[model samples]
Target: MYGSQPARTGRTTLLAVLLAPALALAGALVLLAAPAHAANAPRTSVNPVIFVHGQEGSAQQWQSQAKRFSSNGYRDDQLYVHEYDTSVATDDHAIAGLEALVDTVRARTGAAQVDILAHSRGTRVAHAYLAVPERAAEVAKYVNLDGRTAAAPPGGVPTLAIWSSLQPNGSIGGAVNVHEPQAGHTESATSAESFGHIYAFLRGRAPLTTRVLPELPTSVEIAGRALYFPQNTGLAGRLEVWRLDPATGARAGLLPQHVVRVGADGAFGPLAVNGRGHYELALVRSGERTNHFYFEPFERSDRFVRLLVSPPGGVADSIDACPGHTALTVVRAREWRADTEGDDRLRIGGSDVLNAAVSPRLRQILGLFVFDKGCDAVSHLDAALPPFDRIPFLTATDLHLPADAQARGTIPVTQTMRGTGGIEETIAVPNWPSDRHTVSLLFKDYADIPSGG
Candidate 1:
């Protein structure tokens, strides 16, 4: 989706034009001596890699690639992402930001030079910085992903240009150009083929493994998506991989064995598991360790497991009824408000509940839901909320009840004005029947009472 205008090039002379500069640049630069290590030691460490995103892209665009780099022993701090506003920002502005970022990364990692990987419009920013001899001197290598520039070496740095059939192939003089006929623009950023080329170009050898895997010996491997909901197309979060004690089935410790970012596409891992035992994988929100989906590996035997952020009971099964009997469906609703007062109610609930008073300066909402024993808690729902709804209101729907079931839903309303505290009351829907189709569990005095409940 972030592809740019294609550059025209001659197909017959593409190979010669592309490799010329890279070969010359390789000869011009003096090679550093390798560190002394055992023959079986891991590959020699390379310079830190700075990723530049394309137009309308954010640092999150490189999540999968970053994880891949991490799997190859690059520490989190050694990898950097240069995020900039591509829409209104000029190439000079981006170049300046990149220059500062590269200096910071070099200082932090103590690397003499850094490698760069840019995609689509990001190629413009990277090329601009490299065109300057002073700035380009800090770059060890440049990997262009599905982006085009003139058939010349970028700042005389060794370059590898990867092109997808979705865009016309282009070349850089003295650089290595690879064309993958099946890969799309975005796929060029996330695919294994792309990583293979990038790893070889930067490290001077093929990757031992193209996919992310655990360092320890493993009998089985788990791979799949970690989604917010079963129906959700994608999710963005951190997956904390923890080891489990086979005997007690308890988590080993607070520290994660390996922590990887789950991409917006929801794909997480081909994570290695040591043996047949229970393991816990949590989808913790970025920066907050406590707020997460903590659960055991759901699919033990299958190679691919889809870990969904669902309530205890399964939703689909709860809605499934006898052949002739119909299940009851309800619309779950809540009230949300945020303003500059001492009173702010934030309610977040599912199988767990979190109710707290937020700062008066921040706007917030309290979303609460209740379900019968056989019914699962609401996880996936439509976005539509009742009137005067703010931008970030929470809505949970598609909750169903079995025949002859009764449950109670509660909404605790509290408000504070000035220094004194306001009224606090619990609004409850007691003995709610499964025969009823719609249940409006709203905050007191906020929603209109429905007729014929």
Candidate 2:
């Protein structure tokens, strides 16, 4: 013992850091005035938000999030939630549940389009309905809450994916599924902790984006927790909040206050929004919607595979546009382009915006990543483009990686992801590629820190 009392403690700490969950601080809450134009907004809107739970979840999973909306002024007539199996043919289950929900929302809202907020298997379900000729007419907006179904997302609907961007280190029991590409399984709607952001999106408000991108800390330390969650239950709006704890992975009440920010983490990228603050979101791949922007720790001793949590704030579009080893490129966002295009043009983020460009070297990598986070991927950006070379995708194929191995797990989204219900998951095109040169896009995020003003 005389050799060292503190020395032994240091060894344990190192072991824990390597085997613990990573935590990042989220954005602070602030109040702001509603835009003046919001008052004159149209009445008959698209599909009302329909929350779909994952795995063994019940309708109660959405209770907390639904309450957040009600408290924030979202009408009850515009809110809905669904529960599906974590076991069985995920595709079949999604198709049946989604079709019914579409009919209900349409009849209830008396509107043709319905916005969708689907989680886990629900993502598959939502797209399945969109594939149905009778149902596509109902969805105007779709926000995939980390639902990883089939492969890619279908076209036509705008999407937003708040993904964790990290991999899971756990196993389905005790077997490690690392490199499986489908390892870190999480749902956008898994926790009651996401209520704040959920409500913000419903009414079209801006989510906080980090002013500074945080670098990974030198070491990580996760202490004080084990894991235990309810095995099976069916309540939708409130289970994740009232029953399960993301930190310890227990079934105890996870009070909203327990949600805290800790440790340095990855860069929370910016989002695009208009005067009303409704920004478009999409996933880099289709079914990958299962990746939550934040993954909470299931076991305090587990590192690398933290549980999925909501974004610390704002839009976290998983966009990596690099052409080759010579250069890295990011798709330029027209978010800040002057509206001389007209007031009708999509408004840029608030007054202060940054200007970043794509390196000419990376010009050949031009196809768009079907946003698992927003409206029809190609169509959304295409609508804004003047037209050029059009390359349709397989919804299940990746355009960037040709080797197939390096592109493992992540699927390339095409016009038709799969056949049946999968078609809805695949996006459709209204026009073909033109022979003209591809139009240039504006990029904002730069991994390389800006040198000066």
Candidate 3:
């Protein structure tokens, strides 16, 4: 219905049609009144974004994503498409591309650094800049988009390595990339809703800590190993946290109580990240009634001990929890809910289909991606169920994540294993490029409350 009008026709309708492009572009940027050609601010200008495509791809690999960002607000000048021989080791021309591109972007924009978003082997090319040493300062942020390289060339420059799910080999942290989804990854950028996390993570924001609901201390842990309360069980203790809504300013969401086991051996957490990106308890106390909530981040043994004596609120505040606290890991949207013949399906990016007006049953806001596949690729005829041909999501089995996902994506995928706490391991991964990867985890104390209500 919205067709372009011929110019100089002098028709009022023609003028309206011609003005559309200018208006649409203006809307993409937050400001409507800002002049279209106004020069961006110096030093604070948005650094150029160099996109490194994935395997089985081309610059066309980013065609859908590129158009999406442009429609949202990103200008063409800010996007640089770096193509390489996917067959080669990726160092030869890729390194040369990075060196030349960084200098060009910095010189042209007068910005101190440039940002990079690379997929799969593309990430390898982007990181190689660190080896040059001179160009390292020219690059501000490097988003290893699903590329699983954990080796960090010693540099103080902060890096946010994005991954799809928890993969053992993918971590630059001193320890293995933490598997706790409730606590976001400290070393790698892991989240289920990759798109929604792009903005803040690109800006260098750490995981946002949640306010455990207002409640009195009902239970206490005697030592780092045991719980003393309504029931003295073999299990150590459990955690109960209320979810705070940043928008409504209320406890709109909540996570089930997570328990930790105390064996004669030692302390560990078998927590996991679920498809929705929430922390799932893998183990619960052998036997117990309801109890208050307390959570201590997995920092050092001292923090675990401090949690035992630590006054509820401020006690665990500064401690670095396993996986960083972020909604990106927890945000989810229900897709293909009405499917009759196929299995349930969901979109794994930060795009939360659950919270949309389409479904009231969806009560959570998890993620938002700047560039999303609106499914323009899938024919409107093929996506729809039958008479109503609306674009639909893929089946459960088809939801795969981008590369490097398992290495980083699982921090928010914790709700799967219900238990106390220990170390949840990835058992089996059935999906890829997924909101939640098919994996197993080992938690100490945890439980599963009926969700999707």
Candidate 4:
């Protein structure tokens, strides 16, 4: 991992060192090397890509794929994301928003046509858009990502339909199809394999690199939105970017690196920072709970970083928020399957939270909200709470952990990958009190899957 400054050995680093031999044996540390001609290759006209996220998803769903596209020679300006309110019943409003977005991207990039990539419920909107001959005429190609099934490519646009484990037999009429057995619904859109197909179909050539390459200077520009979950509505707040200790997830400095005023649009950043650094994105609002977000690392410049937040007594108010304990939201794009072998295991504070009752394969849960369900100061790892389980792509569990009032104690979280020889990653975060602060963590979905894995 690259860091702006020398990073000291922390608990997570020590654990990784202990597993080095296993990682080496599994070849999990190997990365795809950039081709010699990739950077200097002849350029071609690239159409701007507009990504349509699924139900209950945000622009952040396309973050990794956008970086991958940039690494493969797509200009940052050529990537666009259309955000909509997924809770709405009909696609009429979303279609209008997308049509306007398409026009805007076309005008900005001066491209004759644009490529459209739609995942999950977004596919429904894309299908509606393409129903109009004029709209279809404006699209050069389309990617149907783990969403609906169709008899033919909508509007006869050249299409690539990627099916996840949930839809092994799904396909689009007259379109090339691929099935990824290891990927879940969201992973089908974010994984590198899916990117390869998308790039090849639109560019008419294989990508020179599939990896998210690190920036040349090791410093990257980051920008994003702080929006209400599902609604995609903006919130006015203060955004603080704080560098964290790589080992313990404690603040590296007493003060934050940058503080930006978030407007009603929920947009912030374009701030430059170390590409490989671990940092906490804290959203502060007057008389409201502060939401803190953490990611693995940024290998390149990212513009789609989303900080999904809600105010007190909002959509997320169902969770027990207490001063005596910390609330946690852990997420991974890949589905957690506990019924089969080669399944993922997530450990919070050294206890595995993934199990048959909590993370069954059929659930396809991507996010987990952890808290003291009844505020009885008891932890139950056996089953998911009904309220969270009813929510799309999300689940919750009761876990009691006394907060460190001073925020000095670290809550160690570890995830052992399904494949890649049990590759283990641990991120320790500060134990912030739940009443005033909430913590969220993001994990990568894919690793090298062996044959028949």
Give each model's clash number: 9, 85, 91, 0
Q: Which runs of model 1 end up more than 4 angstroms from their true locations?
A: 1-45, 215-453
TM-scores vs. true structure, each candidate: 0.43, 0.33, 0.35, 0.88
TM-score of 4: 0.88
Better of 1 and 2 by lDDT: 1
| Deviation of model 1 at 23, angstroms | 40
Cα error of candidate 3 at position 105, Å: 1.7
Per-residue lDDT of 186-265 in model 2, one digit per residue for the tens? 32243322433444454466323211112122222221111111122111111111122222212243242123222122
Q: Give lDDT tens digits, candidate 3, residues 330-421.
A: 11221112222232222333222222232111211112111112322221112212111221211111112332432332221222221223
The Cα local distance difference test for each model comes to 0.49, 0.30, 0.33, 0.79
Candidate 2 — which residues are off by over 4 angstroms? 1-46, 149-153, 165-203, 207-453
Ranking by lDDT: 4, 1, 3, 2
Ranking by TM-score: 4, 1, 3, 2
The numbered model that scores best in TM-score is 4
Model 2: lDDT to the true structure: 0.30
